[model samples]
Target: MNARDPQLPLQPDEASQIGAFAQAMWDEHIVPELTHYIAIPAKSPMFDADWEKNGHIDTVLRRAAQWVEQQKVAGLTLEVIRAPGRTPVIFFEIPATKAGSTDTVLLYGHLDKQPEFSGWRSDLGPWTPKYEDGKLYGRGGADDGYAVYAALTAILALDRQGIPRPRCVGLIETCEESGSFDLPLYIEQLGKRLGNVSLVVCLDSGAGDYDRLWLTTSLRGNVTGTLKVEVLTEGIHSGDNSGVAPSSFRIMRQLLDRLEDAKSGHLLPTDFHCEIPPERVVQAQTTADILGEEVYKRMPWACGGDGGPVLPVTTDPLQVLLNRTWRPTLSVTGVDGMPSISNAGNVLRPFTAFKLSLRLPPLVDGNEAALKLKALLEDNAPYNARVSFVPDGRAGAYGATGWNTPDIAPWLSGALESASQTHFGTPVGYIGQGGTIPLMGMLQKGFPKAQMMVCGVLGPKSNAHGPNEFLHVPYGKRLTAAVAQVIAAHP
Candidate 1:
């Protein structure tokens, strides 16, 4: 982890000659540029109203493309591609050196980050990049920003070594945080300009605690909605309706109890169905062995004493991974139509509503899940009370990454193992990602023949999209070099 250590990797000779040079450039220039990249709060869609006015997305593209341009990559053309009303697309191309070897590899990344939420140990801020204790504290630093830098550094390193760099293309979007609504438009408008792509590298995902190159097999789909009930025309004083009127609160309780069993968090319906891939189970077992207790500590919260059946907290790692990536889960996100305790009215509210969010298994049919959930709530609601369930936004899950492509498995595995040795204390291990990246699926549709490789610097306890997000800097620098090495060796 020491920055001064020269014994790190790719011994002075076997080391990527070009990568060594790019390493100097990355440390002096790219790393500093990322500090500015992290400082901009260009939250996509969540803070879209501010985004257009702030024009922060444009600032990010400028910095990213400018950094790429400074590399002095030969035959590489960098351009800011934009269509009417859409975010800027940063494109860079390196033409083919040989006739049959002119295959294009597309690199993908996003500039917009998630909204920075409050509450942290005062050390982590989304807009502030600080290198402390060997980690880089900032937003979008690891989740993907590094991927952008790494991809460019990778191709340029090969170009510097006098190696025949593959025909390359780059795509950096500003709205990936908002499910990439403008992505289809960008691809459609520049479909031909993207050139003949043979491979893709998504630098948005994460690694295991030991720095394993994580390959996601699948991401769970999600559907969220609200369930409401009305028991009376108006609120009556609780003191006055003590024994006479049926409280809406009581009815809502009954309806929800029928929907979710408090004793067990499992959903009662058979609406969700997905057979887990055997490779995933084996991978989970490998993760359990690699992460061990740190996996348990990294979850949201856990019960300290390991209490009774109706325990207040839970912390099981293998089960946790299973619950997150493969199984279906539902949670009551928020409650509506309820007054604050400070209001202190003796009145019993006449209506109540609760927000419901569900994470579904792959291929579970989003519309089917929606209809099944609607029927479950409507049929289970208390009679004589007006009850309704309405579904809001729903996003389908992506399939597991395709690993059968030629050269991908060997190229990635070698880079990861080398990086782990040079960075962490042990070898690499694989794990599945819980969140969905829609671009992964969309790219598959546009170029079915291209190979996809996903890797990043986030690991266990390196929270993203939550309070106090950070990227491991020393590890990231090494990982960037690892990516450069991979691209250098790619056939």
Candidate 2:
């Protein structure tokens, strides 16, 4: 898309008015709908194995579609598209006011949520929405059920102000939390419907802070699976096996040692590593200067809480950002074959099993990394004991290469700055997200010429996919206005 100097559509007074309208929309419409939405246990397909049979997915999709239709924006169309054995896609569209304008803006989000994790405060539950201190606590609201509402509100705000905007499409899928397994099918079937697009806006990312708008320029993909090691046929008395055989847990540690340094938390494999782009490094330094202590303070560090006090690996904010977004890391998410402490006895476990999760840099191929990891961990087992590395899933990484930056970057930057200063009293910030949204990579590949923007309200301590996940109400409103500004300035 060619860049043109699009004048600021909203003056100071007009921006104030739009901000108020956006806030009102959130308080009166978005929050109420979100409360109802949070009540549905609409877990993703991975978590809810019987999602289709339980009918929760269908129920929530219908509810969301009904609400969007009720908005009744002029020239708006909403469709619920379904393919065999795949989750539904809610396709929403608004025609551009300028006749014959073919420029399309694709806005993306998801309704399916991560499983209801444990450890919520006594009063907060995953399915129960709570509003307090300007924060709405729930599972899917921020991580993002508010996406469809926010996207449409932006266009609606522009239309209300009589600002010319490009044709807009809002695509909300139901399988994102499960790694977007079904999105490709819908994209294939609806390719024609999504014509040549000027820009793609994804509202399913992270924000470094609430004081300003944060844009995600990169995302680390992941490979997940189980690693198992067996040394003995059955559990034996510790007294008998203590000196006779190697502990299975020890064997498991040896296997993992081949992949990562236990003390330094560094991935040992060279293929899993990548060089961080210079632009991203500069962005990280600028962001660090803007947020020094807040970088780690914003986390849910235990002030003697139940999770216990924890320290960041490093005090330097720049390194923290780089380590999270531009580096490879490994985590042990779950384990099996170990008895509970209460039921445990003095015995040598027959086998040790662990769920392995690895985060690869944006430039690494998840499939290739997984293959290398399997070889590194499963081969040459200590004592020739039985070992297995079964990779259950892999999603490749994504990077917003310099070429993805459209000519309209300056205009979009101005819009973000205006919106942030008007509502947040701070300048906008740019940062990369540490988590994965595999769809970004897919879209980037399919529309290599399209400009992309990634922004979301999953800010500090929002705890998406964890206990007490929440959406900041005020930030949500301001974000809606920011989106409106971008749409209004698109040329």
Q: Point to the candidate with the largest lDDT.
A: 2
CA RMSD of all predictions: 5.8, 3.6
lDDT for every model?
Answer: 0.68, 0.83
The residue pairs in collision within model 1 are 217-400
Q: In every candidate, how many clashes are there?
A: 1, 0
Off by over 4 Å in 2: 1-8, 303-309, 394-408
- lDDT string for model 2 (278-392, tens) is 9889989999999898888787776554566678788899999999888888888889999999999999999999988788888887677777788888888999999998876
Cα lDDT for residue 233, candidate 1: 81
Candidate 2: residue 180 Cα off by (Å): 1.0
TM-scores for candidates 1 onward, in order? 0.80, 0.92
In model 2, how many backbone clashes occur?
0
Pick by TM-score: which candidate is best?
2
Q: Write the per-residue lDDT of candidate 1 for residues 1-491, one digit (tens) a residue.
A: 11222223345453546446556766787678788888888778545666666888888888888888887766778888887766677877877543355567788888888877767667667887886776667888777777778787777665555444457788888877655667777788887887877667777777666354454555666666788888778888889875676767777777766656667766566666577777678778778777766665665564355552323224666777777677776787678888878975888788889877677775566556777777777874565778888775333321121122223456556766665554444675667666656677667667786666666777766788777777776566666666655554445
